[model samples]
Target: MRALKLVGKTLNFEVESLGIIEWYIHAIISYQIINYEVLPADTKTPIEVIIDQLSSLSLSIDSKNLVSKNYFQKMKEDKLRKIYPYFLKMLNNPSLSLSLSLSLSLSSLQTIKIIIILDIQIFIKLMKYLKI
Candidate 1:
């Protein structure tokens, strides 16, 4: 979660385009929410604030800026790998899992499926740890 905040903050300063920053922020918030169970209480509040801001943005603008290809790749390699344990926690909550599945981009979903196939042992370990 801290890493996410750092990424968000860094992108906020480094990216000149509002559209790109907004897109990245939205992706970060979505990823955080999907893995909420592992986050600390203090971290949750800031993420909620970001979500509120995200909600206020025009949907048309968001759609126009939503380029999931590069963002999804970065998320998978950087954020997702770092939070795989929390992602497994997400599976324990049926509601969260359902929402996450529903919210994911098609490419992101495909990436996850491929990861699971390639890292079956890690997936098995996570499931076992959760006693699922």
Candidate 2:
């Protein structure tokens, strides 16, 4: 019974650590989006790289630990389930626009527009999934 309790405590710690990591990732992404204009040009790529690394690490962890795999998978699914409505509302609200009309180059504007459209598409797909 002591061994079992030890296992339980370790699993709980791992799960909580994963949650903290995920929360930090989300917070960083949100901060970048909100402060895009002031961010350095190289900022976005590094964040993407970190996220990709984290994703691969998570996948490896999942493959090695069945319990953690199940927990993380459910966590991801639950986040997706809850995100669509909030995302749709953000897209629909003009006040929440990320546009910066501060004489940005045409290429920059185009990039921003493309990113926004892609996000909208993903959110729309999520909405459809929820409806089904």
Top model by TM-score, which number?
A: 1
lDDT of 2: 0.33
Candidate 1: misplaced stretches above 4 Å?
1-25, 29-118
RMSD list, candidates in order:
18.2, 22.8
Give the clash count for model 1: 0
TM-score of 1: 0.19
Residue range 1-132, candidate 1, lDDT tens digits: 354344435434221111112224445446556545344323333433333433443322164564433333343233433433322323333332121121223454342221111134544453454344
How accurate locally, in lDDT, is each candidate?
Answer: 0.35, 0.33
Angstrom error of the Cα, residue 43, model 1: value is: 31
